[model samples]
Target: MLQIFSVTFPFFALVLCGYLAARRRMLPLEAIPGLNGFVLFFALPCMLYRFGASTPIAQLLDYSVFLVWMFCGLVMVGFTIAVTLNDRIRWNDASFGALVAAFPNTGFMGVPLLVALLGPLAAAPIIVGMLVDMVITTSLCIALSRLDGADKHGMAVALKNALRGMLTNPMPWAILLGGLASYVQLELPGPVHKTVGLLADAASPVALFTIGAVLARSQILTVESKHAPIPLRDYVPVAVFKLLLHPLLVLLVGVGAVQLGVPLSRFALTVMVLAAALPSASNVSLLAERFGADNGRIARIILVSTAVAFLSFSGAVGLMT
Candidate 1:
């Protein structure tokens, strides 16, 4: 455990530093988006591309890992909505809540951190899980959120918008282009590849720091606003589901699939389980707010899950390793 914490603590501490910086106005809230843009558009995509280019196309699209993670994610989405939905919380809030429960912060946090913990081989499963979350799970949850509206075409419209959003996202495209480059044995010019590597190298620390800044900005906004106190039922259960139950569910289902003769790698299963254990994606709050859902509930769940993940994630790493 001490050895694991030695690895994990610095990552969490970077997060704490960003949180404190934003909280103390050392990093102004307005500047958070610039950080987010740099990481998302410039840094993270390059990192994914670098890893993806090196990884074989087969590993990147490992159907066994992809299917297993996708199935488990759907179950979480449904289970969370079932448990949290009520008269007050309708489809908009409930579905976004389910989203946060099921959608781990894999793109920004998991790709770099899991690879750091489990080595380069871990990138394939982590990317597979990220693809599943971004392509399938996210679209489904967004579509479900539209069920609250009277618009007859709400689901279809939401699904279209979600797919469009995914298309605009550079990460998947980077992975895809990298996979193609890998598949065809293509090489970039020396300078171009070097530039990509430079950006890729900046990804882990910068992305992790950006996560903390975003979370801190959210926390600050949440505290300053005069909204009704969010009930524990609104957030805690979802956070618990994200940090504890989601990973357990992934592990159990992954093990079952292996027992059932699925050609799943134990290493991939371990990666998927850890991916499931990550905190809720911070972007979900923005999604909720945009779609007229309860961003407050989404924010609370994200905050709680991220705060708890330090202990739970390290513990899982300790136990799994």
Candidate 2:
């Protein structure tokens, strides 16, 4: 566990640099979107392409565990709706609430931490999990946010919109293309591989820094002083769902996998649990803004849950590892 700590600490430190830089105005909030674009569209995709393509297909197939994790996410979504169904917070806010409750910071936080602790083998499961997340969790949040408006589109339109969003997402596309390339045995030449590697190396540092910048610029805390109720109560259930229930569910699944003879290593299991315990994606707040939901509360949840997740992740490592 202590050895794991040695590896994990540097990742958190990068997050801290981003947080502190933004908090101190060393990087303006306005720069975050562009930074995000670069990470999402370029760095992450390149990294995914390079790594995902190289991983063996048979190793990537963790059908039982994947099903379990997806089930956990679905259960959390249902749980969120039940908890947030009140006049105090509308249904639209509930959708964002569900998203906050269910979506882990699997991209920025999950990938780097996994790579650091578990080595290259962790790439396959993380990529698989990410595909599940983007296709399901993200789509639901967007569709639900639209429910609060008068523009009631049909189910087909909502489905189409969600599919489009997923299809066009550069990060997912990169992973998909990389997987195809790997499957087809399309190896890149040495110089191109080196170039992609260089860009990929920049991903973790840049992403963490951008998260800090986004958090710094977030308006969540400021809404507290306003006359509106600010959805304080809504945060309670969502945070509990994320920081406490989510990890427990993952742990249970891991234990079951162990019992059923799943071939995951200690390191791989550790990555899965840690990824599960991470806070809601920092992107959720931006997503809330895009869909006309409660952005401020979403931001606060991201910040608070991130702080909680550090402890949660460390504790999980101590107990499981």
Candidate 3:
């Protein structure tokens, strides 16, 4: 466990560094979005593209891994909603809360961190999981968020909006282009490849830092005196679901797949489990804010899960390794 902590501490420490930087005005609050934009648009897409282009097409499109992870995500969305829904908590809150529980921080944190711990092969499962969350889990949750809304189209409108968001996102397109490049045995010009390589290399540190800064910005924005003090019930349950339940479901389902002769590699299974074990994606709060959900509660859940993940995620890695 101590050894595992040695591996994990720097990652979490970077997160803390971002938090403190934004909190202290070292990185101005206004600049957080720009930093996040650079990461989302340029750094992360290039990183994913490189991974997708380099990985074998078969593994890149590993349907079994996709199905197992997707099933677990589906279960998480329903289970979390079942437990957390109430008079005070409606569809939007529960649905987004469910999203946090199911969608790990794979892009920003999981890919690089898990690869460091597990090696290069870990990228495939992590990337597949990232795609699953971004393409399907997130879209479904967003649609669900509007199922009870007064908008005449309700879920249909939300679904269209989700598809629009997915289309506009560069990450998936990068993955697609990379896959096509891999399929055609295409390579970029030396200078262009080097440029993408540089951006890919920048993805890890900048992304992790951006996550912390985003968290700090969320914390700062939600600290208004007018808002009611948060209770444990509002955020802790969802945090527990994200940090514990999500990964556990992945592990159990993965093992079942193996026992059923699904040919899922143990290493891939481990990667998927750890990927699921990742803290809630930091960006979910932004979605909550955009969709008019309770951003404070969402941010609190992210902060709690992330803080605890350092210990919980490291311990899981120690045991699994």
Candidate 4:
């Protein structure tokens, strides 16, 4: 239908543009890392700040819905393993697996898609979800990964790292400052707002273009053909958990919360689930490489789960809309 195309085409168009640019060598592979940094630290934070500041704090701070959804994701891990053919992975791999399953591509894909299909009011819930994602889910992943590797630093270190990461994160700061400003009824200065708006506007298209460049750099086709054989079985459980189980868990939590008199919009519920259903962040590979985790396996997990999430996400949309 034209409605669906109106919603879906822009996303794919960005992807297509990025892919074509890479194929044409208009953007070098090496520029992607720096471009990603700009998107993540500068553009993304500016966008989140604006989004959070613009949203009503009461709606964004819905503890009931947030907790229920978070709990459901926490519990679903074991259930996923029981239902699927999973391996006995070490902590690093398990940490990566759980996060890939739980943390969707909310920043790059979910926000833009929601803006198109759902509209402006929907941005509030998307921003709230993004806040939770940056502050909680990511920190948890990093802590658990370190724990998985037998780091004896205890909870203190984990908490410290998490907070430090949050403090260092420009987007979280934006959200905080914006929320405070909103609470105090301060209006954004016109010229400052305009400058941020321009930079934030570039976030989605440029980020997606960078993702395309990264994917092209991976040379998936060649790897698929020439690498030592990968056990397709290894990926099956990760895909199942990330693509199918996680979204369902979020939906179940949403329905339960709604039934229990939690004040959440159906639209908010939809955004939360879509956020859960997005593929793993592209940075998973980058982090794995830097940390000496199993980067190869992690890359495969990212690729397979992302490839499958398209269908999974379409299903979520059908249920929600």
Candidate 1 lDDT over 1-321, as tens digits, reads 998888888787878888888989999999999999998899999999888889988998789998898898999999999988899999989999999999999887888888889999999898888888888988998888888783467788888889899999998898898888889988899999899999999988988888788888877787788667899978999999999999999999989999999999888989998988889998888788778787777888998999999999999998888
- Candidate 3 residue lDDT tens string, 254-284: 9999999898999999898888888999989
lDDT of each model, Cα atoms only?
Answer: 0.88, 0.76, 0.90, 0.68
What's the distance in Å from true for residue 88, model 2? 1.8
Name the top lDDT candidate.
Answer: 3
Which candidate do you rate higher for lDDT, 1 or 3? 3
Task: Write one digit per residue (lDDT tens) for candidate 2, span 1-321.
Answer: 678678767767777788787677687766777988998888888888887888876656667546766777888777887778687677777888888888888888788887776678888878777877888778876776666562366445666877887888888888878888877889889999898999889888888777766776775234433635554575765877898888788778777877888765565566667677777888878767766676777777887787676667767667765
Model 3 residue 118 CA deviation (Å) reads 0.8
Ranking by lDDT: 3, 1, 2, 4
Rank candidates, TM-score, best first: 3, 1, 2, 4
Clash counts per candidate, in order, are: 0, 0, 0, 0
Task: Please identify which of the two predictions, 1 or 4, would achieve the higher lDDT against the true structure.
Answer: 1
**Better candidate number, 2 or 4, judged by TM-score:** 2
Q: Candidate 4, residues 42-149: lDDT per residue as tens digits?
A: 887787777777777886677765676667656654453334323555665566666666666777767777777777667766666666666776677666667554
Give the Å shift of residue 75 in candidate 4: 2.5
User: Which residue pairs show backbone clashes in model 2?
Assistant: none
Model 2 lDDT, residue 77, Cα: 78
Q: What are the candidates' C-alpha RMSDs? A: 1.4, 2.7, 1.2, 3.3
| Model 4 error, position 42 (Å) | 1.8
